[model samples]
Target: MINRNNWRLVKDYIKYRAEIDQVSAKTLRLEETWLEHTLNWLGEKSIDQAPRIRPVFSDFVLSESENKYSSEYLRKLVSAHRRFMEWVSINKEGYRHKITPAWLKTIKLPRQPEEEREHEFVSYDEIIQIARTPIKSLRDQRIQAAAVLWFLSGIRIGAFVTLPIKAVNLDLLEIYQFPSLGVKTKLGKSATTDLLLIPELIELVKRWDQLVRSKLPDTSYWFAPLSPETGTFDRSIKAVGENRTSRAYKDLKELLDRSGLPFHSPHKFRHGYAVFGIKNFTTLAQLKALSQNLMHSNISITDGIYGMLSNGDKKKLLSSFSPATSSAPTDLNQKLDEILSLLKQNTPIKSE
Candidate 1:
């Protein structure tokens, strides 16, 4: 059994790396859970006992796989183990090269399922329903606003929760996701994105923005806290910080139920933005603009991650590339016209 002191040392090392990596608090918390599960399973087993522990580790991974853990999840567990052991091999005395003989060489991660990989993004109609759903309560109104904002701005729920009222400029149709301003952006990234171009989406955001400002200071969350007692925004409440993200999810599910629509998380809105935006973009410049608006580092990252087309859409698109028909099979003039038309617009003529 690995001693308690050794476990503490491992934990400290993980913490040290987390700080250096600037991992989000939520992700760090999950990594801690994964590490704890692993170390507990290897209880009291010194790093040098890797050879004897190989079978045990393998069994543990097999059990998790059988229990329906996702390929992504299993991969994360393996990554945790690899990172921990690498530290152990380097820092622990007499543990040199020990990780190489351990189960790392034997473990193979499972492939991710296709259904999970190519999930459909939410549709514009769905967001309209979510936004227009009739509800009498202020809390319900807030939920509707949340849904519309997700569709319009593609804001991640984490950052949404932390947004202060002033962070959004409804008149300018801009959102400032500044972490130093307490927006809780991933990797503390700071950027701005324009709101959705649809007038309805803009109006929905405008209404909520005005309502929140009326009730609280500019620094209060745009999605203000709901008073548990009255089930509405507490105008008198002075406390400032993010509301629980889980509660926002619950509200979304409740809204979906009321609208008789399928439940999709706020993050899926981002996917919707990518899929729908790319589909209609008439030029390469427009595509690149959308990618930048979504805060992707490069156009390829945007395409690789969110540019998935449904099977039906793919077929329809390919059919458009087929040769044009003419009145007679030997109509050379018509055939040349069709070919020339296709060739003219084959590339985007829009200025970069």
Candidate 2:
């Protein structure tokens, strides 16, 4: 019979090890969730019985992979068990041999196919269409601004949820994604990114900025919740407690439904921004600039993630590069930059 004490020990070890690794609560919760399934699969067997259950571990991983879990997700599940086994071996010496490298190696993780890894891109034109096909109230404007900002800045949805109005400097045409300033960037990554060099996008964002500032504190979220009675942003909302990603999704869906455009998630905006920017880039500096603007660690990482181009895009782009034709118009690029600069000057020091 399984010893209850041993089962509890393994559970406690997961929490302890997760904390030492400094993983976020979301990640820790995932680890715990996957491990619970592992325990259930090993029903009636104590963790100390790990040596006898080694084959079961291998079988379980294979079975789970065969059920069609994505390779990345399967890898996480395998990693969760590996970490737990490593912890059990160190903390509970009797199971050391069962959890050794050789035994753990028997567990197979699924490989993610290339096609399954790609995200659907939401085009800049489509975002503008969604923004233009407006609905009633300040809430509708907030949703439109959220969609525009995603394409304009390529900020992750998590960071966008907690972004403070002060971090978006319309005057400078820059967004400061700093954790110190209460922007929940990935791993607390901080960067100052210039807004997309599109005059219409800048104007759209400026209207949103002015609308929010008129009702809420600078410290409040750029996408702050609206007050039902006042039909303006609720100044009393807390800065960081709530995660509004789902609410953002619902708002976007409402807009898309009204506009007769198929619904696309907020994350698709990041993919769209990367694809649009990379496809139009004429210089290495411009390429790297896009990478930095998206908050990617380096150019290679950006390329690796967003490098895949559709065959249609490839054929059209190659045909445009004729021997008789000169390089992309430098004047057009300069004009774009100049328009962005003109809009930046309108950003008042205190955003009055």
- The C-alpha RMSD in Å for every predicted model, in order, reads 6.1, 8.0
Q: Write the per-residue lDDT of candidate 1 for residues 240-328, one digit (tens) a residue.
A: 44348888889989989999998888888888878888788755567767777788766667788888887777889988764655245
Q: In candidate 2, what are the lDDT values of residues 1-352, reduced to their tens digit?
A: 4356656876677668566767776777788787765676567877656656755664676575685766566677778777777777776766776667676665555454644433467876787787688669788888888888888888889889888889999898888899898787887788998778778887888998997888678888898887779987676778555447878999889888997888888888888888888888765567667888888756667777876666777779888887557546786587567445533443212211
Against the true structure, whose TM-score is highest?
A: 1
Candidate 2 backbone collisions, by pair: none
lDDT of 1: 0.75
How big is the positional error of residue 337 in model 2, measured in Å on the Cα after superposition?
A: 29
lDDT score, candidate 2, position 123: 74
Return the lDDT, model 2, position 74. 69
**lDDT score of residue 316 within candidate 1:** 93
